[model samples]
Target: MRATTIHAPFDMRVEEVPEPVVQFPTDAVVRVLRSCICGSDLWAYRGEAARQPGQRIGHEFLGVVEETGSDVTTVQRGDLVVAPFMWSDGVCDYCRDGLTTSCEHGGFWGTVGSDGGQGEAVRVPFADGTLVQLPREAASDDRLLSALLTLSDVLGTGHHAALGAGVRPGATVAVVGDGAVGLCAVLAAKRLGAERIIALGRHQVRTDIARRFGATDVVAARGDEAVAAVRELTRGQGAHAVVEAVGTEQSMRTAIGVTRDGGAVGFVGVPHGSGTGVDLGVMFDRNIALRGGVAPVRSYIPELLPDVLDGTIDPSPVFDMTVDLNGVPDGYKAMDERVALKVLVTNG
Candidate 1:
């Protein structure tokens, strides 16, 4: 079998590696059919996030059950499924409370000695709690499969951001960043009935997707200029809610600046570079609330799945580029160079 490995910055290879097997009674082996590179993967590719040489990398995947351990009963051979970025034991208190990411036994893929989602197959721990079944027929529908793939991460994550930001019917919402997650945040806000959505981004291609996803306004500026544009658009009142989808200190500040005095900000950007340390003084004086961290996507998937199946939301557009296992190195290059919005990795 062949899987993606990182040897250094901008170097990913699809080389022969050991195939996974059912290692625990709660485990299952999935024959991967679809997987994609996440924006966060770039942290490793850019050398910003420390990763051991030859560490397996990738976190979102959809596949069919090839085998399952004795304790795994919710799925069987031939069933199509999607795995969240993290695997968690379903019976934990946090899992019951919709915080699966914090489950007592939860763990992320691509860690030391773990198989990643970007390969021919994966060893899924806590299969029942981490894998969500999708219709078997979807395997043949390329576009639908692509849309369903987002359920494994981005769509659920975007929904998490909107929920944290307190999006409600008729509320004015602003999203910072125009990457795939940010654009999906705009879509989530629309699904929640936000009347006005302001998307901040400088990329025409991504901002264009933001419009299609439900952004009513696009601010193509940064710093004070971007803040002023959003404020002016809201008549100096700012947005009722702001979502920080970029995990930069400046982006967080902009999210706060674009929010109404009494509003809230939901941030989902992976924090790097001391990006999201909020100012207590500003939050206290403005009566603003801040909430958001790594999204527990497994908790949100059940609610968002039906919508994707029913065509209520089509997030497939976020995947502007597609590559096979052999092209993964180029895929990382495309994303790093901003030549692709998001790269979808497909297998048969």
Candidate 2:
């Protein structure tokens, strides 16, 4: 089997690696059909996020179950499933409360002994809890593949951001950044019934998708200008809710600044610079609420899967470029250079 490994910044390679096999009774061996590069993956590729040398990378994937452990009765062998970026046991207290990302027995992919998603196959622990089965019809529909893939991470993360920001029907919402997550946030806001969505982005290609995703306005400005643009769109009052999808100090400040006094900001971007430290006095004076973290993707997958299957929303456009397993490095380069909104790596 071949898998992607990051040796250092700007160095991603697909080399022959050991195939995954179930070591625990709760595990399931899945043959990955599709995987992709995430925006957060760039943090390590750019040297901003700490990553171990030769660490296996990638987390977004959907596949067919090749084998199942004895304990995995909920999902059987040959089931088509989407594995959330993080694995979790479904019975924990946190999982019961819909916060599976904080589950007591949960873990992320690519950790020391775990298999990453960017490979021919993965041994998914807690398979019954972590893998969501899809209708068998999904396997032959190429158009649905990308949308189904987004449910593993990006779409769910965007939904988390919108939910964190308290976006509601008839409310005005602003999304910071135009990355895949940001564009999906626009879709999430719309699905939640937001009356108006303002997207802050400069790229024409992404902004176009943002509009297709339901962004009512696109602010191509930056810094203070961007803030003013969002405010102007909101009739000088700022948005009722803001989704900060880019993890940067400047984007955070913009999200906070463009939100009304009593509004909330849901930040889902993988923070990249100096942490997400904000001035206490500023937040105190404005009474603004801040919420969001690694999204509980498992919790949201069930909620969003139906929509994807029913064609209520199509997020497949996010994957502007597609590559084979061996083309993983070029996929990373396209994303890092902003030449592609998102890249999908297919093994079929």
Candidate 3:
């Protein structure tokens, strides 16, 4: 089998590797059908995430189950499944409370948990707890692919951001960054009944896509001016909810500054550097509440899957490029350079 491996910063290659096998009673092996590059993957690709040489790169994917261990009951061979970025033991206390990301037995897929999905096949730990069974026929629905693939990460994270931000009917929400997560935040906010969704972006194409995803207003501003633009759009009152999707100090500040006093701020960007350290003083004075972390993607998948299957949301538009496994190096490069919103890689 061939997989994408990172030897060092800015160094990525495709090489032959041993195939994975079920190692635990709850584990299952999946034959990769589709996978995509995530924003967080860039940190490892850039050598900032403490990954070793030849580490596998990728976390989000949809695939068919090839085999399952004795204890795996929710899924079986031939099932098309999507899983959270993290694998969790469903019996953990946190998993019971819908905070599976914090499950005591939970671990991340690419960073600290299971083998990543950016190859021919992967071994999924806690298969019954982590994987969501999608309608077997959805693989070919382009409109639903966007939303279904999101059940694995971005769309769920975006929805988590909106929930943390307390978006409600008739409320106005502001989203910082125009990436897939941010655009999906706009979509989530709208789906949650927000009357106005303001998306901040610099690229015309991204802004256009944001609109299609439910952004009622687009601000092409940068720096503090972007904050001012969001504020001005709200007649100096600022939006009721603000979601920070860019894992940077600047975007975090933009999210905080453009929100109204007592507003809610949800942050989902994997903190890149010292990007989002909070200012206690401002938060205290403004009476704002901050919430959000890695999304409990597994917890949300059950409710979100029906929406994807029923055509209520089409999240797959985020995947701007698709390539065979051989083109994964270019996929990473394209995502890192902002030439593509998301890159989908197919093993079969």
Identify the candidate with maximal TM-score. Answer: 1
> Each prediction's Cα lDDT score?
0.92, 0.91, 0.85
Expressed as tens digits, the lDDT of each residue in 1-348 for candidate 3 is 887878888888888977889999999998888888888888887777778787787888888899999999999999999878888888788999999999887887655334777888889988998888888887776556556777788889999999999999999999998898898888889889999999999988888888998999999997689988988899998989999998787888888888899998899987776546577788899998888989998898888778778877878788889888999989889989999988888776
lDDT of 3: 0.85
- Considering summed lDDT, which 10 consecutive residues are worst modelled in model 1? 271-280
Clashes of 2: 0
Q: In what order do the candidates fall by TM-score, top score first?
A: 1, 2, 3
Question: What is candidate 2's local distance difference test score?
Answer: 0.91
Find the 10 residues in a row with the least total lDDT in model 3: 108-117
Please write out the lDDT profile of model 1 over residues 1-348, one tens digit for every residue: 889999898888898889999999999999999999999999999999889989998999999999999999899989999999999998999999989999999999999988999999999999999999999999999999999999888988899899999999999999999998999999999999999999999999999999999999999998789999999999998998899999998898899888899999999998767545587798899988888889999988889999999999999999999999998999999999999999999985
- Tens-place lDDT per residue, model 2, 1-348, is 889988899999888888888889999999999999999888878988777887888899999999998899889888999999999999999999999999999998887677888889999999989999999889888879889999999999999999999999999999998999999999999999999999999999999999999999999987789988888877788988899999888889899989998999999988876756465677899998999988999999988999999999999999999999999999999999999999999996
Candidate 1 residue-wise lDDT at 90: 89
Which clashing pairs does model 2 show?
Answer: none
Name the better of 1 and 2 by lDDT. Answer: 1
